[model samples]
Target: MPRTGDEFITVLKKAHIEWGNHRHTSTRGVVYGEGYLQIPRSEARTIGIFNSNSSNTHIFNCNSTDGFLVNASIKASGSSTANDVFAKQFQGNGNLRLIGDWFRHVNAQVGDQVKISWTSPTDIEITKL
Candidate 1:
């Protein structure tokens, strides 16, 4: 099922994901984490984590300019004491990039899914599943 921003936030909160603010006032963007959270984008490029250790995988649906659509998935596995999963999608004509440590538990699994819809600059929409 598709999830709204609030719904997605609730799910992340329940899952105990980290949260942070991505401030890009200057040329380079800065991401600071207060707890656990996920960020959504309305552009098209690359998205997903590189080093994750969760037992879950996330799927994403993305639409790009020129009517391009792509689905990206990230997966990780380990002993029952440690697992991680990260996934993302790219949409529109922009670029999407995911970074950071997804999971760090001794015996736990993690996963995520992100969906994006591009309609313009201020009309982009994202749904989490």
Candidate 2:
């Protein structure tokens, strides 16, 4: 049995995820478009989203709430799919965008900085900062 919070954390780290897990990946991004942000390929690599494949596009299905939009998603456009997936070309870089009216729901403005955090692999959350 764990006696303190810190001890519990250590125990959880040693145990399997089903027991308890608390880990996430975070990255900062700037809103470049009405509903999009550009993240460098290197940064995407650090966040574990970059794919060198240059053919398959990666999408991050996310959940966000601002009292209006219930669900939103982030897409990381691949090199080859960039032209077809989005109107803007990133010169082989990854493009992250908030689908639908999520930009307005989050009250995000062009050039505003936002934080992207995700746990496990699929769960994602975005916050303005």
Candidate 3:
């Protein structure tokens, strides 16, 4: 079953998403590997963190107050290794702005430089095609 936003964040925190004083930032063409995605200093935001998921080569979301966003995407290289499943479970904190797949590979350690990006949630009006 898919996890909620709050549940997701809890998992991230436990896994250790790089704790930064500033908010979000963008990926400046740097590739992040397993064990804590790096947030660059140039892309800091007021309330967001950008990360690359190693599994499907996608960018995922992790927030401070709100746990994990649900369905967001990131660009990754096709040559990267597949992310290992069955790592850990995420718990939400209820402040997710985006959404995506949650995993246990994130482990932002102390003093890890990360490139953050600010992505506001867009309200889209869906219609049957």
Using lDDT as the measure, which candidate wins? 2
Off by over 4 Å in 3: 1-92, 95-104, 121-129
- Give residue 78's error in model 2 in angstroms: 4.0
| Prediction RMSDs, each to the true structure | 14.2, 15.7, 15.1
Model 1 agreement with the true structure over 1-129: per-residue lDDT tens digits: 122332222123322332234332475544442222333321111223212343322333333222322232212111222332332222112222221222222111345443334333223333444
| Top TM-score prediction, candidate number | 2
The residue pairs found clashing in candidate 2 are none
For residue 108, give model 3's deviation from the true position in Å: 2.2
TM-score of 2: 0.46
Model 1 bad stretches (over 4 Å): 1-16, 20-109
Q: What is the clash count for each candidate, in the order shown? A: 19, 0, 38
Question: Of models 2 and 3, which has the larger TM-score?
Answer: 2
Question: What are the per-residue Cα lDDT tens digits for candidate 3 across 3-75?
Answer: 2221111222322342221234464432222222322222112122212332321333434322443343332
TM-score of each: 0.22, 0.46, 0.19
Task: Provide the overall lDDT of each model, using Cα atoms, as 2-decimal numbers.
Answer: 0.29, 0.37, 0.26
Order of models, best lDDT first = 2, 1, 3
Candidate 2 vs candidate 3: the lDDT winner is: 2
